[model samples]
Target: MMEFFIQGVLHPLLMPAHLLLLLALGLLVGQQGVGALKPLCAVLLLSVLLACVSTLHWRLRLDLEVALLVCAMVTGVLAVLRLELPRWPLILLGILAGVLVGLDSAAPRIPGLRGHKIHMLLAGTVLSSTLIMLICALLALMLRHLLEGIVIRVLGAWIAAGAILVLALYLLRDRLA
Candidate 1:
């Protein structure tokens, strides 16, 4: 914490601090634990500050990043309670999901699938995917106006950015558990 304070708004510490807070908030919701709220609030504050301070493009993309995290946590809980997919199935789902998300993100506008599962549980693959679209759309509309085909750039960046995020999650898993 002191390291982050000293580094001020621009420190690498701030992003992780923010992510950890955001993840903790999800965990608290998952467990229905009330105690985590204080820290979670702190983390969000740090993330906001970091975005203002850091020059990194990813920092500017925090809202989309956090939106994806929230959606993932929601789907994860539902997956645990309902899907019960075996480890292999989970792996396959991960692979296929990566592809779908890539498609969803990269495409200029996502087409409606008449009977996709997103309509069923209302918690299907596309539900979370839609959340990503909504957040990205808002970000794109606000950030640029050049017909940048900007959403595709964001989509690609999010995927690559997600790979890096997995490393952070790995650290969180090891350190926290």
Candidate 2:
């Protein structure tokens, strides 16, 4: 049993398990049910811990997507609160943040854009990436405002996405089982 545990499980693949737990925690918090805050706080705290773990000298690297997702959520919440801020700018910032630190393979190379002035080039790339996310979010906010009828469509899309993810999880679980 111990050998089986060591070889088949308790490895890097557990990362997915961690993500699933995070998703469940977020959805539960959004629901605002009993004991919600506890789990929400725990999830947020765990995320921070995971992020920190990735930064240390150990071999394991924290996944960039987790960091991006956390940042995205934080910025999203902030954007909603600070309605006065230009929406497009905020969205563009978000996209840049997401792409730069998003654990995507292409993110790091972008910093080397300029031949000799690597620092300047990288900074520009990061700025551009963030600008794109902010733009997208801003556009989304604008569309939400302009077409009142589009909200239904937005809601439907969100629901459909959730359903698809659930189905995917179920299929994966079945295969594993």
Candidate 3:
């Protein structure tokens, strides 16, 4: 039980793509000002719930790894560009990111989780994802407040580079496999 809980907590942190996307998203949204945070977080929670339910029971067949990479790339670029999108668009972006992360994190069929109740596993997954997202957002907000804006842009560049490299590896996965 402790092991499963730890696995759940580490799920987002363990995945490079998800980690990058969450951090990039937090940075991007943090730039949008304090007013955007509430709606963005709400959408994130809703999207995660939707993904967990759908992916677990229905086995929604989508290339979620690629989708997560793509999300990371887009959010990274948005951070680098420092483009101030309207609040609504950022909310939409949050929803999309949450869904992708949820799908990627849901591993109901994994060996450790095989005998666990679906709801129990999903609850852990959701909790971990939300915790990570909030932490990322808070860290981004702190950095934004503490340092010059250029630092955030540099971080964005690094995130983008990481996403690109990961995407390349994923593309070549067939050969690597």
Candidate 4:
């Protein structure tokens, strides 16, 4: 269990793309104000649950890595603009991001956990994904409280810029190869 939990936490932390998405989500939620945070979190969690379960029997052929970069771009732009979008749109964003991350993280086994059942892997991935979102949201909340809305927008711009660079590299990789 400990192993699964740690692996869940570590994988996203170690992956730059995932890290950026998590943080960007946090910043977006943070900018949305405290009243909206809980519902957004709930929506995101539900989305992750559905996505992970869906992955057990199916994997989308969509380029998840590129999708992640795209997520970063969208979320970053939202944050940068400090858009006061309506509730449904924000919920949709969470759902989209949750599905993307869950799909990417739902591999059947971790490096040394070959004997573990697929269900176990899914649980751990869900847990880890939840943690990443929670921590990022919490940090963004703090930053918002301390630094004001402008700072959040700045962070969002940075996130989008980083995503652009990554997306470009991935798109160009085949050509380079």
Query: Taking the tens digit of each residue's C-alpha lDDT, what string does model 4 give over 26-141?
Result: 78887777876898788878888798888767887676898898998999999888778788988888888888888887666346655545556567667676677777777777
Pairs with backbone N, CA or C atoms under 3 Å apart (clashes), candidate 1? none
Instruction: Please list the C-alpha lDDT of all candidates, in the order they appear.
Output: 0.33, 0.35, 0.78, 0.79
Q: Write the per-residue lDDT of candidate 2 for residues 1-177, one digit (tens) a residue.
A: 343323222221233322322332233232222333343343343333333233222333444544444443444343233233433443343234333232221212344444433333323333333333233333444444445424423433443344345446645886878
lDDT of 3 by residue, 79-146 (tens): 88877799887888898998888887666675565555666666676777766667667666667655
Can you rank all candidates by lDDT, best first?
4, 3, 2, 1
RMSD of each: 21.1, 15.0, 2.6, 2.7
Write candidate 1's Cα lDDT for 1-177 as tens digits: 333223332222234422322232233222222332233333333333332323222223223433434434433343223322334443333333333232222211236633422222222222333233233334433433334434333333443345346646754876878
What are the runs in model 3 whose C-alpha is more than 4 Å off?
110-116, 145-147
Tell me the deviation in Å of residue 99 in model 3. Answer: 1.2
> Which candidate number has the best lDDT?
4
Name the runs in model 2 displaced over 4 angstroms: 1-60, 66-117, 149-177
Lowest lDDT block of 10, candidate 4:
109-118
TM-score of 4: 0.86
Ten consecutive residues with minimal summed lDDT in candidate 2?
100-109
Error of 1 at 34 (Å): 42
Residue 40 shift from truth in candidate 1, angstroms: 33
lDDT of model 1 at position 56: 20
Cα misplacement distance, residue 159 of candidate 3 (Å): 0.8
